[model samples]
Target: MAVGAIGVVFGDIGTSPLYALRDTFAGHHPLPLDQLHVYGIISLMFWSMMIIVTLKYVSVIMRADNKGEGGSLALLALINQHTTGNRWGKGIILLGVFATALFYGDSMITPAVSVMGAIEGVAVYQPEMHPLIVPMVVTILIGLFLIQSRGTEKVATFFGPIMLFYFATIAVLGLVSIAQMPQVISALSPHHAVEMFLADPFRGFLAMGAAVLAVTGAEALYADMGHFGRSPIRMSWLAFVLPALVLNYLGQASLLMRNPAALESPFYFLAPDWFQWPLLIIASLAAVIASQAVISGAFSVTQQAIQLGFIPRMTIKHTSTAAGQIYIPVINFALMIAVILLVLVFQRSSNLTAAYGIAVTGAMLIDNFLLAVVLFKLWHWKKPLAIGLLTMFFLIDGGYLGANLTKIPDGGWVPLLMGIAIFTLLTTWSRGRALMRQGMAEGSIPLEVFTKSAHSSATRVPGTAVFMASTVAGVPSALLHNIKHNKVLHQRVVILTVHIEDVPYVEPAERSTVKDFGNGFYRLTLRFGFLEETDVPAALRTVTMCGEAFDMMKTSFFLSRQTLIPSDKPGMALWREKLFAWMLRNAASAMEFFRLPTNRVVELGSQLKI
Candidate 1:
């Protein structure tokens, strides 16, 4: 899992040295290979990794799991769990959801930038191939996405060894150059970083944002921790990945110092021309792997988003019976199209690099903010340690965010546009859901009254009937209609509300809150961590522990499908309100989300105007 997880989490950051060194030198500042610039860049990279990756994430943020899962949703769930139904919790939930929305933008751009960057080497080696780059890339990208339905288990097996070899090759190439100029190692000093900034304060600061591209996928490390476990990721980074990355970077700097003309793709130039083509092939393969990692990540994140209710559930296919083997066709195709378009428009990795870091860095900044809340509020860490760690991470992340801002005029507008579009969609969907629920509640009977009236008025049926409600306190229209239509109440009634808490993972203790409503009727509120996937049928199986055996054949699950009544409601804009309604109509049935038996599932429709 660590090997597989590494290819997913660290690929973006891992491949950064490919362009980071070149971008920093020829970036907005265009600094010379003076000791200060070299040392400053090295120092900044090291400490950025230390604070952002090592301290904040590995040491602190990973500790705040929602059950055993960790990610934006997981952290949000933790805050939600502790804060309960409070305004602040709502705010944190929005922040977390927004962060998640931004990740979609990152996911789209990562493949575009990485693949473009690698393929551009073709131009460097054979300029004639430049004309074919976009087409070639498009073809490969389309093929990659098309195969997603088939699953990546077999393809992923080679990812570890290939990435390991790539890392080793770069490290060896870098070390060879560094051995010739051992003084390059001294650039690790913080004073050099300070001096470079002081000498060209504005440009240096702007460059930090582009430099941030080097660590774009840092958040994925934490998001993926559940897949690989903290120990494996931590050990891999400390023992192997980090050291190799540093050595290669230092070697690149050493070569840059000796041959100032090597600024054109220092990564490839570090190797002999004879090896350049082979290096390009190796690098391109690595880039493709990096892109695949993010693509798969997008699928996983989308699944969580749908389950959590911030987004409408779309058709989700389980490509494998294995846990987390989800394939969301809508999201996969959407990303594939965007990435192909990006490659055509940006044309080169250097151009797309400007658009890359902003979304990722913005997401990373949000991760730090949420981590702070987790450390102080959830983990109950002492004030000093929490504050210190938060401050360190914020400064490092802030520096990169500030730098990336400079690229806005030079194509950085891509991610910004992408982020705004995604954020709006997320906010609109979440707000719209709330308003729709409010409208539905206005027509719902209070649970207490419904229980009293339906007990005797409704005819008795032979088996169990489970009604899925948005809220536990309100009676679902499905239940009301079921009784009205058949005039039959089951021998047992279960009002099950699946609450997608705004957290990453849910602990076992917080799994279900059960209340016996008397007369063989039960209210079950199942709480799931954002990290844990929700299965309705599986949750039903646990009702026995609450004093009821779940008989599948005798059980019927009911869900209310809310239809939209577009009106002059003083809620959302007319256009957005209509869009929300359309989305609701298209979302996958609640029966699927809850893992309910398809044959026993029942859906009722009710019109809502919000």
Candidate 2:
């Protein structure tokens, strides 16, 4: 598992050395290649990793997992489990949701920057090939996305060893360079970082916009915790990944100190002339693995959002028997388009660097708020200690964020704009769904009342009918529509409500809650964790309470397909209502979403004003 964590969880942060040092010295916000500036930047990078990734995430944030799951949505769901009815719940939810929103921007930018940064090594070794860099990056990214549907299981088997080799190579390159200039090791001390910033406050602050790149994928540690577990990820970071990255950064600085012109591409220069091409190959592969991790993380986050009601149900395809190896076509293609555009527009890795750090820094700052709630309200840490830790975090993250904001006009606006648009879409869907549910529930009849009165009022059919509802209370629009149109009820009627719990998995023993409503009517509620996929037929097969076991051929599934009518109801703004209506129309049908048999399902359409 620790080896796997090296392959997957550390890919993003591990690959940071490719561009983090290069960009700091010669990026859009270029710092001098002198000893003072180089030492200062390396020192800051080391400290940022320690504080943000090690302290906040590894030591503290990973402990806030939701039933062994981690990520913004999982953490949000965990918070909701405890703080659902609190007055401040809504605000915290918005912050958590926006953190997810920022992640989309990060996802798009990561592929563009990481891939381009690695491929740029070719241009560094052979300056004549520079003109082909963007095209090469675009081609590589498109291939990466195209291969996503096939699943990463086979390829991922090689990832651990490949990453291990890459890390070892870079560490060796750094060690060789440091041997020539042993004094470069002195930069590891935090005092150099303080002294440099004190000597040139404004330039040092601006340089942070680029230096923050060193920890671009720090959040992946928390987000990918579920895949490898906390201990494996922690050990991978502390023992293997951290030492390699720090050594590589110090080596880059060491090279710069010996020859300032190495600033053009210190990472490649660290390698001997004969080893440069192999280093480039290893670095490019590492970049692909890093981008793959981010893309997969996007899929996972989108899945969580859909289950949590922040996203509309899209067509999700499982690429492997493993529950986690699933694919969403919409997310895949959407990310592909965004990444290709980023590469085309930004053209160079250095230019893309301007757009990179803002989203990451912004998300980290928001995590501080989420962490605050966990400490005070959930974990109940001592006041002074928690406050002191939080205060330090806020200051460090606030500085990074403020510095990154200065790059907005250059290219940082890209992620900020993307984050805002995605945030609006997520919140709109959630709010709109709530309003539509309320509108649908306006005149709902109780299940007990309907079942008691229903038997005598309608003719009895032979096979069972399962009417699905989002909630357990009252008669569903589908059930009401089915009886109203057909004027008949099945011999055995079941109103099934699926409740998505806040945790990641629910035990099979606890999934079904059956209540006999009398007169051949049974109210069934199936509980699922937020991370679990739904399969109505499969869950139903295990139930023996509906007089007899469910046979697929003898059962018919009924679904309510709401045709949202945008009106001047006191719900949402007109534009949002229309947006929700469009989303409803486009979302995957219940039969597809729940893995129900297509031939055995019936959809009843009803128009509702929200």
Candidate 3:
């Protein structure tokens, strides 16, 4: 598990050694290639990992996992469970959604930048081959997304040993350079970082933005907690990942002290001449592995958003028995286009550097805020201790965010724009769903009243009719339409409502509840964990209340297909309502999403204004 965690979770941070130092020294805002800056940047890089990744994420945030799952959406669900309807709680929820939105931007950048950084090494060995760098990186990214449909179950086995070898190789290379200038080891001291900051406060502060590159994938440790347990992730980081990154960063600094010319490509220069080509091949492979993690994370986040009603339902294909290993083709294709475009636009990893940290720091800042809420309100930590810990997080996270904001004009606006677009889509879907529910409820007749009034007069038919409803207490629109047009009711009527719980899994014993309404009428509420798939037929099999099990031939599923009309409602602007309508048109049908049998299903259409 530790090795697997290292491969999957730490790939982003592990690959940072390839371009992190180069960016700090030769990027958009190049730092001085002198001993002071070298030691200082090295010190800042190490401490940033300690404070942001090790202390904040590994030690504190991982404890807030939602039933072994972790990520912005999981944490958001967890926080929503603890606090609801309050102003501050709503604000936290928005921040969480925005953080998730920003992650899409990160997802696009990671593959483009990481692979480009690795491929750039080819230029060091065969400078004439530099022209192929962009094309090669694009090809690699295309291939990565192309294979997502078939799943990673087979290829995943090699990830662990390959990444382990990558880490070990970098560590050995770093140690060799560090042996030449043992003084680089002194960067472990906080005094160097402080001295560097004291030398020129603003410049050193700006350096924080670039230095953050070293720990870019810190959040993955928490995001992937479900895939590998917290203990294994922590153990991997503490015992292996963290030390290797620190040594590599320090080694780059030591090598820079000897040869400033290496600043253009310190990571590849650290390799011996004979070893550079093999190292480049290894690095390119590792970059692809790192890209795989980010791509998979995008799919997971999208699935969670759809389940939580923040986004329209997309087709989700489970490619493996592992619950965490599903694939979303839409997300995969979208990321592929964005990443390939990024490779063309940025052309080099150093150019993408300007766009990288803003999203990461923004998300980290929000994570700290959510963590504070959990610590104070949920964990019941004392005010003083909570305030103390939170204060520390604010200082670090806020500082980094402020530093990264300086890059906005250069290229950071790319992520900010992407994040805003995503946040708009999410909030729009959420608000639209709520308004649609409100409209449905406003016109809805009481279930008991409907059954009492309609059942006696309507012609009774044989077999069971299952009406899917949004609310447990109300009559489904499909049933009303059926009664109005056909003037008949099934002998056994089941008004079924599916509820998505915040938890990851609902045990079989607690999966469903049924209440008899008398006279062939019954109300059934099916509970599903957000992580669980919703299959009406499968869930119906667990319901033993009615006589005999549900037979597909005799069981008819009814679904309400809502046709939304834009209106002067107070909820959203007319433009947004139209946007929602368009989104509604594209969303997967309820029957498809719920895995209802096609031949046994009946859809009744109704118009809604919101």
* RMSD in order of candidates: 2.8, 1.0, 1.0
Tens digit per residue, CA lDDT, model 1, 209-290: 7667666777888887767788878877777778888898898889888998888778888888788899988888888888
Cα TM-score of candidate 3: 0.99
How far residue 535's Cα lies from its native spot in candidate 3, in Å, is: 1.8
Model 1: worst 10 consecutive residues (lDDT sum): 539-548
Per-residue C-alpha lDDT of model 2 across residues 373-456, encoded as one tens digit per residue: 999999999999999999999999999999999999999999999999999999999998898778777889988889878899
Q: Please estimate how well model 1 matches the true structure, expressed as its whole-model Cα lDDT.
A: 0.80
Error of 2 at 513 (Å): 0.4
For candidate 3, the lDDT comes to 0.90
Name the weakest run of 10 consecutive residues (lDDT summed) in model 3.
Answer: 565-574
- Looking at model 3, the pairs that clash are none
Residue 7, candidate 3: alpha-carbon lDDT? 86
lDDT of 3 by residue, 174-204 (tens): 9999999998899888888899889978888
